[model samples]
Target chain A: MIAFISSFISRVMNTLFKGRKNIKLGLYGPPNGGKTTLANRIAKDWLGEEMGTVSAIPHETREIKIKEQVTIKSGKKELTFNLVDTPGIATKIDYEDFIKHGLSERESKKRAKEATKGVIDAIKWLDNVDAVIVVLDGTKDPFSQVNLTIIGNLAARNTPVLIVCNKVDLKKVKIKKVESAFPQYPVVGISAKFGTRIDEFYEALFTVFR
Target chain B: MLTLEFVPYHEIANLSSIGRIRKLLNIAKQNKIVLLEGRLKKEEEIELIKTTMEEINEDFKGIELAVIYPTKNDSGIFTKMKTNFVDMIAGNRLGLTIIGPASIVKAIKKDPTKIQLYTQELKKKARKKK
Candidate 1:
């Protein structure tokens, strides 16, 4: 009876003292490629946050948008995943519109001049991430300049990249060709717009995170 | 010389026959030199190409099966094409040339009319500048 009681106490102590592992994941891709869509999906279903804005416009997310302290349970382990959603990378448009969305015109114009700086800021944030989800448009060629640049940068950083082929529900989207082109990387296909294969996406997230 | 460009489809799920053809059409529109290279001779090579093409559609232009090195698989063609593609995409003149069987090369060489027409049109557009 004493041994049983001691074991119970030890288990309770372990649970109390064990710190939750916090993993930081970045969702990045070219403008209009559904980064926000995927981020919002994960935030809503797994992170328990309301869905953020989803739009067809490019550069919908102009700054580093973050949803912090999301708790996830796997088996007997509890983990915390801090999901960071970044603005789409646009060569032309800087954070002017993004700043204007929340600020006055003078401030928006001031930030616009620093648009290139915003991209640099986003790249710097990559160093802090544990893994990256590089989203690609399902209806366009996967070899676009922007997409390749993003992947190349991620690879250079030695960051594990999970290529998410978004908007797969569209009739014009193709998965096989993308798999063939990037044979070395882990690729997942999902329609972020409709949330299909979302559970599978989460499974992939857990696999890479673990 | 016959130039080939492999354009991977937009979506990972869209790596079907139809998706590949659509992507090819789009690439053809942007550049007149691009052609769809033939399939691999070996069944396994074909399968591997197909699988890889589906995942990394943007990375592959087409698979070239070289007759001189029949035993030597041409999977490296994708990486080479990717480099050339990047150069061209950056507004450079980097072109893609695929090495394949003699017969395939001869067949492509025989069709100069399409390339000639494209070049002629480009010259015509250039002449307008002068």
Candidate 2:
């Protein structure tokens, strides 16, 4: 009787464990769309720390950065995700471009090569991501090669997407335009730098990403 | 208060990425500068550019677009030079990207050199001089 009871209890424990799902949430976007900044913001809010460095140069983050077991709570409901912050995706990576960003000839070439590889790595990771948060620069035109590719890949894979319009603090912000650009996805406009409208972003995060 | 043409404000949250590009092209076809708030995903941007190129012939030669971001650093003269007009206009993944008429873009670029760099930095030699 004790052996039978133990087996029954084991089955019950398995069922309980299966009910709690941990998602792999991804951050994807073009170079310098503030993916790291937004990643840092979310990490800071929930994990009490930052994940990666932010820089003025493009492709500053050329590695797959992850923060495991990040659990966010909204009242009684709580969700946990393994945050995966990937490198920015781009169609082109010219060493000359990095030179324009003040890197030396050797450094620019090295960075460009790494960035290209990073783009490939980021694409390969799409299959593993449960959902994605696309971070975009608020003041820029939303229609571009990089932005379209990321959204298209996500749609093709049937992964949920949350588009974050970062840098609303800028003077020329047109969040409505971004809202219009990707009418299908939930677009949250926040100054990730200053944490403006971040609460709304978090609330939207729960509703949309969940 | 800004209305997004046919897509109702609330309903926009349901339009697919393709639908948004369609709407964007329609607006751009009218010769209006479509200032999209956020940077686009790579594929969406690619399709937009491809479809845009295909549609260009008589009425529209191209479209002019730019991406703007808030000042991150107090950029020094050298740093500004690094991302100078030639560099930023050409290399920025996001920046003041203009894809419209060459004539208009030319007029826009007629006096780019006059624009001031974000912030100034003391020259290394000047520091030693002082």
Candidate 3:
């Protein structure tokens, strides 16, 4: 009962104050799903600065980083929000997995600890964001547990979501599979690395936020 | 040897979200795959992940979880209504949930109708030479 009341109140508050100030838009997904790459793309496009470093190593962004008051203009329409780039969420975080990426045991343990805390932080932030952008790796299967969990949590909160099928530059990208997997939300295919089809993503953002 | 424990929905129906998460995590830490009769609430699922992360260590890595529920794609109106009625009576007990320790369960591949739980082969420790 309390949870439902709080969720209702938050939705009301979000609706009452939409577009009045910076909308807190969050980037969330599983590990190595290109969330940081998309965050960097959005930050570079609007603020002329990158949000965080991207790496092939999972959990590289082991903290919740934010770029404030980013404004993007499409024709006469303009949208401003605080773009929050969060760590990749995972069901399991093993230090040994980091060792496979060539990190020393000691460094791997430290990274694993930080990554665990990062997942907790990302889940906590779900309550604060008015809207969210779920980034998915287009080359991977979208029906994984992590993806379903993330989408389910968002649905439970009734938070607005835009699914970005990132890494479209790759040859084996399966954007359609992602779309079919999550047909409920709006899915856009884009190469956040090379900035291909980014305009479509920005355009889709309007539909979500509006 | 692998163990699978079946937990009925009534076993956790009255527990709070935190309580439910703790119960499931404790079972996973015991290195057994939990075959729950019904799925958890969405908020409970998030809490379960958070709790699992907090308890991760060398021996207890984490948990891999998946829920298999019936989709309402082609069901008739009466069938949909019957499902909803049962949900109201049984507190949404229309699905199955699986939670296993990450050390033992490599991955859980799930489709709408089936689940493929892949278990990793346990490595044998070397015996000492006298």
Candidate 4:
């Protein structure tokens, strides 16, 4: 009976202490900016979760998609990340999809607007987060307003921004200009679609977080 | 009303690390409107802005926070975060803050005369510097 009790108590303690420390990281960018694709890669490679849906349409993520807990290890350090993937930035949206998805269009629109506000919230989350990953499209001009604004805001918040230049495999994409543009910040060029830079991306995250 | 102009660091030749540091120190000394333009990701820009603000705050008793973006469409997650950070930092201080896009189209849409006057003053200041 004493051995049985000891085994039960040990089981409970093991369950409680087995998990790593959770680090909340938010994936944020403009509409259809490969944010989801990168999120899926991170989730699958680090957390062992199955890949989520990927769509070409903007605002594909109308709500926050969260993967509760996934453990990632770097050397002797272990961290559990509660990765939150947010909706893309959109000035306006179509209500039909929201209704079809079983949510009110009015409410969805409100949520969409709130999603923009979530960017601020995400920055504030930096106070608690270990690091943040900012995804960018390599195919587009790096000097665009959205990219600059996002980078500027992140700078103001004092959050460590890891610029992931995604979609590098595309024929039209060129990383040289992008690399030259933001010399002050660390940037990792990756092709999220084909998982070309997945290893390097993880190494960068570990370096930053560590 | 602190105005900041962000320029790509690589665009400026002979802009060594020390030169950039000197420029920042000068901006701090002048209490002038400063801008930080670069083709950075959201996180990189935010980190730079925050560090610069902290540096400015260290030198000046209560420096205002203002972020100028090139276009209205550029206003997104990062912009919202900037406003929130400004509000947070402004809460205990004198609290002068302005966060918006610096696009001509947006300015004209809101108030052409005000934007024109502002631009005129900037150009005049540039001429004086020249």
Candidate 5:
């Protein structure tokens, strides 16, 4: 009788203590949607370092980048998770597009090829991540194929998602459009570049992951 | 010869993710390779891994999945022609992934020159035992 009671108590304690630690939080979105910018912001706020470089050109992050041992606290709640910043997901990747941006024929084609490989690497990383943040450009329409594909994939895994409507520092950004498009998930608007409304993001992160 | 059925991405795209994955698993269990055009939906891929892991048994081992992409290069007209031709027919040819029973892929080698994916037949003993 005493052994049975002890086992029950131990199991309960394990469940409670296993609250949240070493979580893998992934940043996923289309090209130039401020994903890396947000990753930098999060890392700068916590770890005092940048995750990866960002560029106006699409798919600048042509690989999966990880920042480990990040711990964030909001009021009484705290989250410790590895931040995984992935390359943008695109439906059509054309080398010609890169050439149009004044890159050399050789350079553009090379970037396009690397970017294409990066998407597959990012998608493969999906299985291991604990949760995902689907970052979107608030100025653009939220109903693009790449955006829908990302959400659909997240939905399929039933991964807890926090939709980030980024680039709100721009005057054209419409947070409502993003919210309406993905009504099921919680949407938080922030200018990751300018670090606006970042505290709310931290609070929401605690809420969503809690 | 690789004994596998081609599941057109458009056909499988319409099914619920679970249904699509279940359908893919059925093909894998039949001891045949699955040449799927395009890529599986993100969720479908994730669920496919989960289901594949759960269904491991004596008859089947694990899955060996591969994506085939044309060698990408920047300088030559030949490279441009090949890249454009593949894109016109296969959409994003880079997105194509091949999934098959691991029993066959274990012995074959990646030649990088000849056949990109060398699909061999499963062992006779494993099939006969079942």
Candidate 6:
């Protein structure tokens, strides 16, 4: 009974406030999946800025960065929302792994500790976000537990999700593989680094959120 | 030697989400791979990951988890209804959950009907010549 009432109220609130300036759209995925890169792309496209710095090392964005009051237009419709770029989610964070990437032992340990906290923050943010864009690597297999757990959590929260397959400019990219992996959601392939097929991403974004 | 601990669904069915996650993490921290009879709810799975991240330290790295559930992809309507009935009665126990310490279990590759759980190989230090 309480569940039904809460769900009803949530739907009502979503209907009332969605597409307004207060909406929060979050970017989430596994580590090194180019979430910050896509976030930079979107922010630069509309807000004339970048959200956070991107690096080859994993867990570069170890905090929740938000760009407020960013507005986007598609055709005759325009939507304004806060773009939230969250830290990548990972199941494991070992200090040794960072050392393997050329960091000193102390730096590695520090990064590992921060990365773990970042993941916890990202998961907690699931409750606050109105919608999400799950960024995936097009060159890697998308059938991992991390991907499934992320999508499953979003589904459980009744949050609208759009899957973005990043890195389509690479020679080994396979956007179709990711699309097949998640046939239920709208998958857009774009190289956030090279800005390939990003217009289609914007079009799909409007359609999905509409 | 690897330790695989089998936990039936009923073992955790009565526990709260936090309790269940704690119990599983405790077991995995002991360097034992947990083979649970049923899968956890989506929320619980997320909570488990969150808790695991909080407990990561020098001794305890984290966890590698996987779930294998029976798929009725090509089933007819009658079969679908039967599966639904079973789920309703049994609380969706037609699956397996594997949780292992990241220190021990390297990776868990899962497909629809199979799971390949890779374990880390312990490296031995070189012996000095006498």
- Top candidate, metric lDDT: 6
Model 2: CA > 4 A from native: A1-20, B1-130
TM-score of B chain for each model? 0.29, 0.46, 0.86, 0.28, 0.64, 0.88
- Give one digit per residue, the lDDT tens place, for model 1 in B60-113: 222222111111112477766865566456321222222222212222221111
Best by DockQ: 6
lDDT of 3 by residue, A1-210 (tens): 434533554465458456578678999999888999999999999889898898999999999998999988899877788999999989999998999999999999999999999999999999998788999999987888788888899988888778999889999899878877876677899999999999999887765564
Cα lDDT tens digits, model 1, A1-210, are: 434533443454345335645567788876778988888777777657754676654554667877887766657755566888876654234233455467666755544434344454566676788668888888876654345446656656666667898898998888866665455566789998799897777666555444
Instruction: Give the runs in model 5 whose Cα sits over 4 Å from its true position.
Output: A1-20, B1-130
**Tens digits of per-residue lDDT for model 2 on A1-210?**
434533443344345335557678899988898889988998999999999999999989998999999988889866678999999876445565578888899998678667766776787788788778899998876765357557867877767778999899998888887776666677889988899999888877666655
Distance (Å) between predicted and true CA of A40, model 5? 0.3
Clashes of 3: 0
- Root-mean-square deviation of every model: 16.3, 17.5, 4.7, 16.9, 18.4, 4.7
lDDT of 5 by residue, B1-130 (tens): 4687787778776777788778877887787878887776556564565466456544465466544445343347888798888878866324555677766654222222223555544477557779
Q: Which of candidates 2 and 3 reaches a greater DockQ?
A: 3
What level of docking quality does candidate 5 show?
incorrect
True contacts kept of 4: 0.13
> lDDT per residue, candidate 3, B13-111, as tens digits?
888888888888899899899999989988888888988888888778898899887655335888778777787887657788999999899899876
lDDT of 3: 0.85
Interface RMSD of each: 16.8, 11.1, 1.1, 12.9, 14.9, 1.0
Winner of 1 and 5 under DockQ: 5
TM-score of each: 0.53, 0.58, 0.91, 0.50, 0.60, 0.91
lDDT of 2: 0.66
RMSD of 5: 18.4
Off by over 4 Å in 6: A1-19, B72-80, B124-130
Task: Compare candidates 1 and 6 on TM-score and give the better one.
Answer: 6
